[model samples]
Target: MNDYTGFPAAARHLAAMIRCPSVTPDTAGTLDYLEKVLAPLGFNCQRVTFSEAGTADVDNLYARLGSGSPHLMFAGHTDVVPAGEEAAWALPPFGAEVKDGVMYGRGAVDMKGGIACFIAAVEAYLEKHGKPDGSVSFLITGDEEGPSVNGTDKLLQWAAGKGERWDASIVGEPSNPEAIGDMIKNGRRGSLSGRITVHGVQGHSAYPHLADNPVRGLMDLLDALLATPFDEETDHFQPTNMEVTTVDVGNPAVNVIPADATAGFNIRFNDTWDGDSLKAEILSRLEKGAKASRIRHGKDAPVNYSVDWVGRVSPVFLTRETELVGKLSAAIADVTGRTPELSTGGGTSDARFIKDYCPVVEFGLIGQTMHQVDERIALSDLDTLTAVYLRFLEGWFSGH
Candidate 1:
């Protein structure tokens, strides 16, 4: 019930939360801290913990202010990536020290800042206008920076089970690149990862005729994957791109050819294809590469290889809810005087999972330092973003 009212309150909340050191999959008392602040704002906050067989159990919070329709969800995560080599930072990674108008900390911009801004905006809005005609909920999770198995996805399911449905969701994931209103991520490209292994005979490198080098086959296969463009840029998305992450022969001796070669790759695909179609296309290219005799030189057994799709496939999606998207854009313009670009160019986020439940978009602070040695954000940016969210809330609730 302490005073959690204005921009100063927001800054204090962020610094306190950062001091908790809530790294990925660890609450570090962040959820408890959030619940205390939220309860004072008349929100019924529920803390839920989810666990799966192989994934870490994650703590999550769902705080709702009203029970009516036109529900607006402010989704974000408190968990942050580890602060590697803390001595490399200008200030302590968890200290949340503000110097020359900037606050340096692990989750300052990447997300804890976003949550702080939203809370401040909500508190300010409620103080002036009481409760909105509709609803507002905070879907904060602690598993976004980890395997994402027990975070927003499960929290949403649990909330829905309790008869909660959202009209729209905004994931505060630092979507802006250079400034507060530079961009708004309306959608995200789908992500798929796989590892391909080619099996071959092991022998001395000097005896070329005695063994087949799987590396040769791997090179051709990878070339096939990259040689052709998946598609031209679509209306709402960019062309699909694939990158080879790891190429391993695991061979120790320089003279010996390894029995197998493996290459791990990840693909960020556009709306041009789904998981099934994309997988089929990849297999077709691999088959073509295996049949090619460029490096195999005439000894062709079709390049004995196998591919395993790693992890879960994140489906491509675009949020075209005109009302939800338009109001958010207008809100940004109202606050920053800059028309935010509708972008879908970044890597995947929890929005991919929330899209299935309701229309979702992303907008938050600038993200030049996320996961870097000295992650930080300008304190001015936090205030500006909080004002923008406050404007959006006012416009959205009034319109509804």
Candidate 2:
């Protein structure tokens, strides 16, 4: 077997991956390298490319070791965000340098490190337990850090089209906050975004009666949106919160009032409401604000405005499969001696798409340095995570 054949090979695998510089939407031959590593291990690897109307074409990989019941899938992406100003990094961003027993690179903790650990775990599992009774697969994509249009969502549909079904999935995202065993994300909240535009007439600043300033109307509408909370905290989720991300008038001149004003806001909601209900609530608030005479007391007409929902709504989801959660939790405790907190307190991930196909959870390396300057991972953390995954694999296939 090649040198990177078993559990101890994780760090080497990660070093090779970090050297690839596979930034968003570009695999940079990372998948090619992965295919070579998994093929000799009896995995049937299929490389697939997907494209849409305006999104970039993305390359994805699906590799399986067996075909049977209780199929377990490992999902992740190879893509990393840009390594801004490489000169600012302590080591070369793509050099995969190890200093003080820590590997530094762009994708070290954000994800490539997680993938490397899982690879080593699988290698170690096979070395000890031989072929698993059921199946194990890797569902990886290169478009995760980009538009996401041609990533896991499309890859899952494509796999399902070929009659692929998973009993459970583990997304190797950076889930831990402070340490390797800090948390495991079992659910994600729903997300909705929109832009509200208020219309008015253009006029010189000196002519107060000649123009209807949309800024005043926008303030009224914004006040209404924030006047009430979305809901109280749910059993498994925090209270729904909305933030206005941007306000734009697009007028460069201070002496002239702009013809229109727009504000963009996003809301992360819990089970208290779905996409449709949340939209209705926002519209209702805007109506109430428009009709109020506090800002435009002299104008009897309501504010002229419209709203546009942005992008697709990511529905909230929680994995309820006890066996899957219990076994993984046990595996972590076995290796780390700490009970991981089951959390649903983060932003969405590709697991949001995988949830529609099978129950999914996320666990990986600490995320303190992910997407930041000098991104790196402790060598000990890498080996620790690998051990956790190996234990999970052994327990999962044994139905223990």
Candidate 3:
């Protein structure tokens, strides 16, 4: 096998990737390095860049080793969130410094490390068994943490237009909370965020009768949003819930009533609902709250409120690909000697997009310190995770 076929090689590659400082929406250096690594492994590497008017242009890498069926696409991002106050880190965030078996870096577990391990697994598999009977590819995006526009979804579309078809996929998102093999994300909840804006009259607070207080309306709207539970529980997902992130009137004075109020909320929903259904339900509650709140004040004027969905609403999904999930679970158990739970408990991931193309699951290193000032992963975990991936790669291809 080549030097990049084990934990040591994987660690070396990971450190090189970390040193690139490929923060989200910026990946020129990282893509170059990846092409260098994949080119030797017989991959036809393509450096893909995508852009939208308002979002940052992102660089991504798509590398494939073969051109046949049972194609397995390994998807991940090289981008790391900004390492806030690099000086606050115990080790340089981009240094990829190793101390006493732990590698400290910005993308250690959140997860350039996962990508590195997958590369190592593929390298070993190739060295041991020659070429796979089918195919293998990497869809590495650079905007997983940014305004996720111009990233995985776009890159997938680009690849699809080129006639790429994936039988199954694995997203290298750090799915475990404590250990590398404790969990596997077979699905993810959908995300919906929006602004609830209530229009009101501006006047002195002392003249309450003359000015409508939109704060009251905002409260009622929020109450309706929170009053009824979206669901109790599902077979594979947790209860759907919403949280009000902000309630703002932008009023600077205590004696004045604002002209408008806005409340922002985000919902993490399950397969029981989709984007349109969830939106309809939220609007219904908002309308009900507006009407009920209007009656509380005994007013003739309609409650003036508008709801605007924000950004892109992610639809909920579950992967029922039995072989994909079952074999991956068996691989984890084979390597770690523990049965991993198939879960759908995470917030959201690019897996949400990959789900539309092929059945995808998430399994990677432990994610305890992801996005923190001193994000790091244990050196031992590098070996363990690579083993899991190695096992999965062999099992998946052989079983297929």
Candidate 4:
């Protein structure tokens, strides 16, 4: 293997990337910077811009170095969440400042650092092995931190139309909560968000027979939804949970009952359930509770109610194949001298979209500071992650 003496160059490149205030749909010049770095590496880079009926146009990039089967893909996002309260930060959110051996920036751990390390590692590998044995590509999008309407989902379809296929894919999301090698995300719990708006007749608190109280109906529905445990423990996942995030009536007057009551909730389910089944289960529980609950002013009249669901459905998925998960885990141990946990915890990521195309997994720097104030990552950890990616590449291509 060719030795990479360009660790400083890689660090500088990452700093440049961090300097771009590419937050969500408005990726100032992040993609341009990426193209500049990849072009010299012999990657055929192309920008795919997409626009929806009402949303702003989004730009995504698909860069590939080689062609053929057994293709490997490294996917990530360049956009980051907004940096709140700049004055509260030790360094500017986009400064990419390195102090006392740690790089501080908005996207440092959440991901821009991973992209830099991988690109550098790939450059070093090509210096030694020439072109890779098969193929290697990058699928980067700017919409990961936004609505995600015109990002990886559309980019994947465009790539497939151009006859692109992958054997395995790795998303460089920071999956480790503690150290570089402490975790590897083999799967993620499916996320489903719903809003239960209970509609009822409005009434005065004193006039028992004049109005209806929607809050009581909403409470009953919430109780029914949470009454039965989704599951104690599935084979590969924890019990599914539903948390009531918000309940709003907007009733300022104490005596007036609100016409409508809304309760929003989200469920992180495991492999045992899918979108359709979970929806049915939720509706069933709500129906049963709504029938049993009697919202009465005195001892006579009860209120009638209805419920509605909101937002997109996310499916739960798990990848246990030995090739993708096993190989990456072994690589982590080899490089970091720690047995990484194969976890299914955490919220959804771009891996959710990639899983449909190929067996996908995630491993990168520790995410303890991701999306937090003064986000940062250690310089030594960057070197360790580069070595880990290099080791995985060598081992995976060697069929070991």
Instruction: Estimate every model's Cα lDDT from 0 to 1.
Output: 0.91, 0.91, 0.89, 0.84
Q: Judge candidate 1 at residue 308 and give its lDDT.
A: 97
Over the stretch 36-93, how does candidate 4's per-residue lDDT look in tens digits?
A: 9898998999999998987778999999988876799999999999999999999889
CA deviation > 4 Å runs, candidate 4: 1-7, 206-208, 297-303
Q: Write the per-residue lDDT of candidate 3 for residues 61-142, one digit (tens) a residue.
A: 8999999989999999999899999889999999888877788999999889999999989989999998999999999999
Clashing pairs in 2: none
Per-candidate TM equals 0.96, 0.96, 0.95, 0.94
Error (Å) of candidate 1 at residue 301 is: 1.5
Local accuracy of candidate 1 as per-residue lDDT tens digits, 75-115: 99999999999999999999988888788899998799999
Better structure of 1 and 4 per lDDT: 1
Q: Give the 10-residue window scoring lowest on summed lDDT in candidate 3.
A: 1-10
Clashing pairs for model 3 are none
Better of 2 and 3 by lDDT: 2
Candidate 1 matches the true fold with a TM-score of 0.96
lDDT of 4: 0.84
When summed lDDT is taken over every stretch of 10 residues in candidate 2, the lowest stretch is 1-10
**Candidate 4 at residue 101, lDDT?**
80
Model 2 regions more than 4 Å off: 1-7, 293-297
